[model samples]
Target: MHDVVVAGAGPVGLFVACELALSGCSVLVLERDRDPRPPLKALPLGLRGLNAGSAETFYRRGLLEATMQASGAEAQEVGADPEAVEAPGPRALSHFAGMTLNAADVDTAALPYRLPSPAMEGFMTSLDAVTSVLTERASALGVEIVRDAPVTAVSQDDEGTVITAGGRQYRSRWLVGCDGGRSAVRRLAGFAFEGTEPLFTGYVAEVVLADPDQLPIGFHLTDSGMYLRTPFPGHLGLMDFDGGTFDRSQPLTREHLQAVLRRVSGVDVTLDEVRLASSFTDRAMQATTYRMGRVLLAGDAAHIHSPLGGQGLNLGVGDAMNLGWKLAATVRATAPDGLLDTYTTERHPVGAAVLDWSRAQVATMNPGPNAPALRKLVHDLMRTTDGTTQVYRQTSGLFAHYDLGDGSTLVGRSAPDFRFEDGTRLGDLLHNGRGVALDFTEGRALDGTAQRWAGRIAYAAGPVRNNLGFTALLIRPDGVVAWDAAHTPDRHAFERAAHQWFGAPSRLTTGAPSL
Candidate 1:
């Protein structure tokens, strides 16, 4: 029995076992952290994990610039306007993963460049060459990946999911944990992840500066709390605050991170070694529920916060690309368990609004007694432009939206960027495992709902080149739109939440001719 096992190979359980072995689904992937080593899981860390949806969910299908030129990862033109940095203009300006905390104030052009800046604060050799081109394209998309198999028990009901592993049993019909954040499949699928851990525990490093101007790309230094310092194509990175529960017996030393990078960059640098060192603690947890039936839960096993607004590996690769095409269209039965229950109804209110913006950025970096007048009123509202577009709408995961109700005009918004009479760019024609249908001239009438969801809806239409209104906007397979007309009604509504959040409409069970 094997359709989807995927417990953990990290990087959201190896991209959800490379998207359930490219949706054919035979997948195994266990990994308790066996020999598979390389640049310590190819150097990924900083602004927060998995830079939101790992390069626009693998840049729709170019597999994020062919896995950063097959992980040799050395592309440095470093932004200034390559046609407003590749046209879509709103959030696309990276300086090799460095100067991008608030992103000079939002407008990621159109997201998904991967790196120039903000892989949780930069310098990870193009995020270990884009996670070694997504672990060599998830092992050429067949995805068996075992690696030491550290599961202990698992078991399931309704006849399928069993696991074990020190003896090896491994059966499966469904089970996706993406195990991390102490999740043993959300603790044997009993569920309840809850929140708040981290009295304070940070300490990170990656030094290599003799005179890289001794550090001053994005600099930050606090009395006893913060100490950031950015920029990293060659080197010059730091992230201090090594005393919360950080005691490898007073560890966090290369002489205490070169004396906190010479007391926050006054200069005096020499710690060229110490490639990586971690000590995290700031989980706001969340899996109170992500699904229990077939045993599902995703990335960081469905939420764990306090990497602050680096949104923890881009919210665990946006919950492993929104639970990998709704669990590969519900294991190809062709969707409808209310589209796998709208992936916990649109990612648990965006993981409780990123755990209330990482506990209000740790109570404005804690110090108490009006914490330096609330950190000078949040550094004058993150140095305004509406607090740098609300800190790039809380660290450029582009404020995940979805209410999916009403006549549905891009349901609860965030689906703009159409422009394709032929020039193309409905985000490069819905980025790959396609399923778009934004008509708008309003004449396609879903082409009979696209031949009643034939081969899972791919039909595209015209109009709305950033007029930013909605004529039509279907979009799913984890991009999120799930129907639109301008939106309205949804008090537990159901009919076509755009074919129930993009897969799972044509169903049946016993009368049985669905698919």
Candidate 2:
């Protein structure tokens, strides 16, 4: 039996499978679609924004370089000019609703905890590139992927779970549903998904426009609805606030798309040929809980929201990163008593916040009379330094933190990618999918404690000029700071944290515990 059976082969599922395999768990991924490449996955239509947290997750796994390399030619085109110095002003990396915030207006000094790292705060990439990179990584890690296999049913007993897909049965110690928002596994597992319904039906389409100049080249908020036209010829996005009456299950016709575009933009935009079309809604929903017995949910299966701010992909990836190691430890019988449960507790709040963020954007985007004033206020605020900084931090996922309950300031925050005096970076140490106890004061107290959990936690001694007011830090496998000590080492406190996350020393075996 496989250790884990992952439903869906999207970026999230592939990522989770890679994480499990990296930790020596046997993983099998089932995907409903046979072809990995699709026209809709290309640029313009498949554009996805990668925030700092998401980029850091990929970088920590030693996957970012390869992923970027896969798109090397494109990267070079977008790469910053070595000789060009950025001017002082707002540099917009992304938008909230349709309102863009400039980076120059943001005060980086305000984010004291942020450190210099190779990961960019935000970058635009294609879904095809991300999926290709993740798929290659998963395959290299020994993950078995079966396509054209849609999970139909899932049942679990005390021993494990039995999954039926494509008329075949597979047994696994655990099952995870990463299949998109309409998750079959989640339905079969009886998860309680609750959230607001859609306010509008959004469309992304690539077509041949007879009169491109008729539509503006940016987002426009009209009386009837909203529409966006990109620099790319024939590409358009529209949102009709029709209470989501459009049937997404049916094939979109050229005539229907043209009608929606004309009505939304208040312009007669002619569509000659339709290449591809897809629809989405602002219907946000989240599973009440992420786990049920031996079956679990991640990615869109766990939570879903509108594509506003491009937070959906990043949020889903974060879920996979948080759940992967914890679930792997549980399957291998090395997890602490409540390790697996923490996944839901920590991620649920994050998901809820993203949903609310989407809702807030939709509120501001409404064509109602009150919306214009609200939008004006938001636009004016975004022009200020503090307002821009706040938006940047939130949209870039830099301000995301868990409530680890009053310890060090670093606790429950992403570990600052510290560069030690020895030229070793914290991210380099995390590539192995292990926790780290980094001591900058050359004290043996934290090292000795970390040694007790040898294979699970890596202990490093190094000196760094920027201490961020911390002498030592305990970083979790997912690069979250589990515990930290300021100025002096706290053996007792550090030991307790180590036990809480890595289990007590007495419970673990030497030389990487076996399953």
Candidate 3:
């Protein structure tokens, strides 16, 4: 029997399996698709944006460099030579409901908590590149992935969970469904998925245009719906608010696409060839709970919303990172009581926030009478420092914080990539997939406490370029700050936090003190 059985080999499943395997758990990943490469996973159609939090998570696992390289980015220049200077260029802008906001307009000074780092705030990459990088990493970590194995049924009891796929039964201590939005595992497991219905059916396609010049580059809002023509000669995207009436199950033909484009763009553009076509909807839904008995859900299997701001991939990856370590600990029987429960409690809110964000964008994009005015207001607001800061923070995933009963400002937030005096950054310490007790003061109190959980929690004492008002911090394996102190050290609170996160010190380790 496998320690964990993960259904679907998408980025989320691969990431979770990698995490489990990294901690010495036997992971078996079952993928429904036989082939890994698909046109939709390539560039132009499969483009996705990785926010700061997602990028940081990749960096923690030492996969960020590989992902950036696979995306054809100048990976060496990203953090290799900080002193290298380059020519100035136009600021990158992020869009909301097709409205763009220049990064330069946002005041970085307002976000004093954010530490300077070589990692980017965000970047664009394709699904293929992400999956490739994660697959390689998962393989390197000793994870077994089987293709053409789709889970047809799921059954769980107190002993374990049984999964039937491709006429074979597999047993595992735990199961996770990382399948797409139309998740069969979720249905078979009887999860309650609830959310708002779609307001429109969106189309994304690559085509050969006979009269490409007829359509201008960039986005267009029309009375019928919205449309976008990319710089790529024949690439087009369209939104039809017909209450999702278009038959998505049917293949999109040249004639059908031309008609939809004409109706949405109000242009008689001719499509000579339809290279590839796919459909999506604003139908947002999320499981009331992420887990049901021995089975759990992650990525699109747990929640799904419109790809308005490209938050779906990032949100899904975040879910995997948040759940991976907790689940691994639970499987190993080393986790404290209620550790696995926090996965749903913490991630459910983030998923809900993203859904709401997508809904807000849909509201602004509606062709209703008030939508134009509201869009105008948002556009004008984005031009201001405060507005740009708020939008940047939200879209970049920097604004996400768990309610861990705030004491220090850093508590319950992602730990900053603080550059230490010895040329090491906080992200460097998380490569081993363990919690960290960072002591900026090099004080003996926290150091001695961390010694008890030495193998479980790495203790790093050093001075940083900027501590951000934090003297010490306890960061979870997911890079979230579990606890922090401003100035004075609290041994009792530090010990309690160590127990809460890493569990009591290993009894087998000699010289381990009682918490």
Candidate 4:
């Protein structure tokens, strides 16, 4: 029996499986799709953005370079100098209701604790690029992936979960549903999915335009709806304020797509052929909770929203990153009390925020007299330095803060990549998928105390290129800082923080001293 059975071989499930297998948990991934490399996941139509947050996650896992190369990202565009001490200003930013923000306008000095790293900006990548990199990593970590195995039934008891897939049954200690919005595991497991309905039906397609010149490129917001034409040939996106009543199950033909294009774009554009097409709505919904006994949900299984703000993929990546390590610890029976529960508590809010962000984008672009005024106001505001910075924080996939209940705001945030005098960075330490104890104290103050956690936490101490005023920090496996010290490091407080997150420390190999 596997330690974990993950549904869907998409990025999230594969990532979670990789995290588990990396930490010594046996993982089996079941994918419903037969083809490993689906055609739609290639190039133009399949293109997606990997926000800086997702970029950081790939960096933490040592997959950033490969994924970047595969996605054709230039080194300098998404990277920073290795010897630098400060993080570069935002290199890229997303849009709000088709209104783009200029990254140059962001006030970088206002953002604190950011240090230089190779991955400082969001990387534009495709689903295939991401999955290829993750699949290779998952394979290296000994994760077994079974294709064409759709999870049809799920049953769980106090001991383990039974998953019926591909006409067979498998037993596992835990089950994670990483499937898409129409997740079978979530439905079969009976998790409550609740959220606001959609406002419009959105269409994305690759078509052979007979009169392409009639429609210009880039985001075009009309009185009817919004339509985006990418620089890539034949790529088109449409947001029709049709109350999301279009039956998405129907195949999108040339006739139907041309009508949508004409109505939304207000251009008499003719489509000769529709190569590939898919429809979505801003229908936002999230599982009430992320876990149900032995069965847990991650990625789209947990929450789903429109791609307008381009937060869907990034949010799923965040879910995998947040849940992977905790679920691994739970499978190993090394988790602290209520560690798994924190996944829902922490990620649910982030998901909800993304959903609302999507809904707001729809409202801002909806066909109404107030929309033009709202667009004008939002456009003017987004052109400001402060507005650009706020938008960057909201959409860059960085700056995710969990309320760890610590009074200090620094504790619950993502740790900056602290560079040691020896040239190692925090991202380098996290490549092994273990929590790290970074002690900037000159005398190795945390060296002795950190050993109590031993294999559960890796310890590093020394002078850093820039400590950002932190003397020491305890970072969770997911790179969230559980504790930090501004003054001389305290052993008791460090121990308490470690215990709170990593459970009780093990007896020191040199023989644990009596408390």
Best-fitting candidate, scored by lDDT: 4
Better of 3 and 4 by lDDT: 4
Clashes in each model (backbone N, CA, C under 3 Å)? Answer: 33, 5, 0, 0
lDDT of each: 0.60, 0.83, 0.84, 0.89
For model 2 the local lDDT of residue 411 reads 91
Residues 164-264 of candidate 3 have per-residue lDDT tens digits of: 99789999999999999999899999999999998898999999989888999988888778999887667788998877777376678888888999998
For model 2, what is the alpha-carbon lDDT of residue 459? 78
Task: Write candidate 1's Cα lDDT for 462-491 as tens digits.
Answer: 554343445555667555666555433221
Using alpha carbons, what is the TM-score of model 2?
0.94
Candidate 3's TM-score reads 0.95
TM of each candidate vs. truth: 0.34, 0.94, 0.95, 0.97
RMSD (CA, Å), candidate 2 to true, equals 3.6
How do the residues 388-500 of candidate 4 rate in per-residue lDDT, one tens digit apiece? 89889899877989999998757889889988877888999999899999888767778768888898998888789888888999999989999999999899999999999
lDDT of 2 by residue, 186-256 (tens): 99999999999988999999999997878879888887778988887778888888877783866799999
> Which pairs clash in the backbone of model 2?
89-104, 90-104, 91-102, 91-103, 91-104
How big is the positional error of residue 402 in model 4, measured in Å on the Cα after superposition?
0.5
Error of 3 at 463 (Å): 1.7
Candidate 1 weakest ten by summed lDDT: 114-123
Candidate 1 lDDT? 0.60
Which should have the higher TM-score, number 1 or number 2? 2
